[model samples]
Target: MTTALRILLLDDDPFMLELMTDMLQGMGYENVRAESDARRALAALPEFGPDLLICDLSMPDMDGIEFLRAAAEAHFDGSVVLLSGMDSGILRAAETLAMAQGLSILGACSKPVPRTDLADMLARAWQQREARARPPAHGGVK
Candidate 1:
């Protein structure tokens, strides 16, 4: 059987973290890890090896933007989705930074990212990953 895709969720707010985790689980994402501590979340990357990461932009100690930079530096190739209630100016800057770091950001969404939206993002990320994994038309000869 094919292995389930792993996902990491980083949010300083306990409520948001739990909510997102439950939403992911309800959506049939089995290997979902939620961490309220940004630092710990970063550490879990190697252990979890998640295929996708959803991080809150306004976290406590180390915000999501910083976390994204660190994760990218560590060579994480997973898709990233930034969640925040910040103004568009902040999100625009974050998006630019994410792009410069070569991070595959699914997109930035407003706070309390609806469960339906989360599910859609997860599905899209999964499909994108599958596409990347497919062999080229020329096969191994390419």
Candidate 2:
């Protein structure tokens, strides 16, 4: 079920991008697109129409914060998982900022993320997707 989600991985480091792609593929997520540039990732959003976006916070051209802003402006409604090697406090702050921007933030994690943690996050995201897809419950009035 979760494997059907289209996921976009954005990172400036080519090695990190490849590693993440490999990790996601190993975890049964086949529809994954990796981009080394935030701008290109933003441009690909409309065409890709990913269900989830895994983004690294530290980048040369445009950092993840800026990328999140751009994504919000572009009206991206998918969930976001922020990845960074920065301080935990900084990562938390980014999560807050993303929430404030109306982005459905899945969560944030440090770099070199453990497979277990990644799997857990993905599971939560899948649950959220399922919840969103369900129709609202009706009252007893009917």
Superposed model 1: Cα runs more than 4 Å off: 1-3, 136-142
- Candidate 1 clashing pairs, residues 3+ apart or interchain: none
Q: Write the per-residue lDDT of candidate 2 for residues 1-142, one digit (tens) a residue.
A: 7789889999998999899999999999999999999999999999998889999999998999999999999999888999999999999999999999999998899998889988988887787778667677773331
Q: Rate the local accuracy (lDDT) of all candidates.
A: 0.85, 0.91
Off by over 4 Å in 2: 138-142
TM-score of each: 0.89, 0.92
Point out the worst 10-residue segment of candidate 2 by lDDT: 133-142
Which 10 residues in a row give candidate 1 its minimum summed lDDT? 1-10
Return the lDDT, model 1, position 140. 61
